[model samples]
Target: MDAQLIAFTGVSAGLVAMPGADFTVVVRNALVSRRAGIACALGIGAGLLVHVALAVVGITAVLAAVPALFRALQVVGGVYVLYLGVQTLRQPHSPVGNPQGGPTARPLRQGFVTNALNPKVSVTFVSVLPQFVPAGAPALPRTLLLALIMVAVALVWFQVVALLVDRLGRWLRRPRVARGVTAVTGAALTVFGSALLAGPLRALLRAL
Candidate 1:
């Protein structure tokens, strides 16, 4: 493998592994059921594919160019994330197999929406990924190849996280433990979402 490719792969792995909304969502759903966890992982993979397609076609570049549009997207993403966090916090603790269901009930869609709305992913594609593509290289093929590598890495990592969470299901699914986990993840999402919204919101308030 080319040195740059290797470096890109390492960087991608590190980025995907970072604990963020995706990680929290996966863990929360994984606590519900292994199937749900895997489903969520697959959904995240699909979201990554969408981002890759958009980035490769230069749509993300357009978003980057339009500050207002990008900030609008960031605000939307933040609100969505904040909503999810509030919903999570409000969720009543239920048994692992409760038929009433939760986000885990549609883990795939939840995961997809969570990831798809994240502007940071688009930014990464627009900014970080391009650095790895050699100048004057056949941009299309090379970029696709690199994107595939990133998607694969992310899928594998999340799947492993889900599997591991499943392995610890016995303990994590307990009433008290599950409630604690829920609280932590919910709070995390809230904070993350707030941070995302902070800058744009401040700008908006200033303009007003």
Candidate 2:
């Protein structure tokens, strides 16, 4: 059990460290404000909890089993991410130190929506958790434990990222740098969304 736990933790850490939509969102918000960044991390943690619950309850399994439903979810998720990228690109510059810049909760919501809508997360939960569960152990308790560990790893990692980015707040807050960062992150997200949309379509076309 200990060995399994260690291996799972290592895998989870690696997954958390990989730069993806979550990383981009956290960094983007962190550049805006520490509060916003932390809020986004919390939202992402909340989103992980939702995925864990769904996976444990077998809802993710159902989604995986039904190809059409999963594909539909991917399409919606892709469109939503694309919209976010466009919104980020369109965002106007705010004066540095303006407390009224925007509601802090906005980033929190963005984090949640961005994570929850991601089909890749659902796939991760569905595919990865089962590998570490002991053959004869009570599946429910073990699964939840592993899922919670993954969530903890993700939350801790993102919090560190947010804080580290916030430490660079002085330079990043400069209008030109901020805009440049925004453009890069926004473009990355747009590309990610495009890939997500294209993957399923490409597979379908090949199948036909």
Off by over 4 Å in 1: 98-105
Model 2, CA-based lDDT:
0.85
- Residue 7 displacement (Å), model 1: 0.9
Worst 10 residues of 2 by lDDT: 92-101
Q: What local lDDT score does residue 30 receive in model 1, on the 0 to 100 scale? A: 83
Ten consecutive residues with minimal summed lDDT in candidate 1? 96-105
Writing each residue's lDDT as its tens digit, candidate 1 over 1-208 gives 9999999999999999999988988887787788888889988998899899998899999988987888888898888878878888888475555323355448998788888888789889888888998999998999899989999999999999988988888788778988898889889888878877997889898889
Q: How many clashes show up per model?
A: 0, 0
Candidate 1 clashing pairs, residues 3+ apart or interchain: none
Q: In candidate 1, residue 190 scores what lDDT?
A: 87
Candidate 2 TM-score versus the reference: 0.91
lDDT scores of the candidates, listed in order: 0.86, 0.85
Query: Cα RMSDs of all predictions?
Result: 2.3, 2.1
lDDT of 2 by residue, 94-199 (tens): 5434322357788899889888888789889889999999899999999999999999999999999989988888887789987888888888788877877897
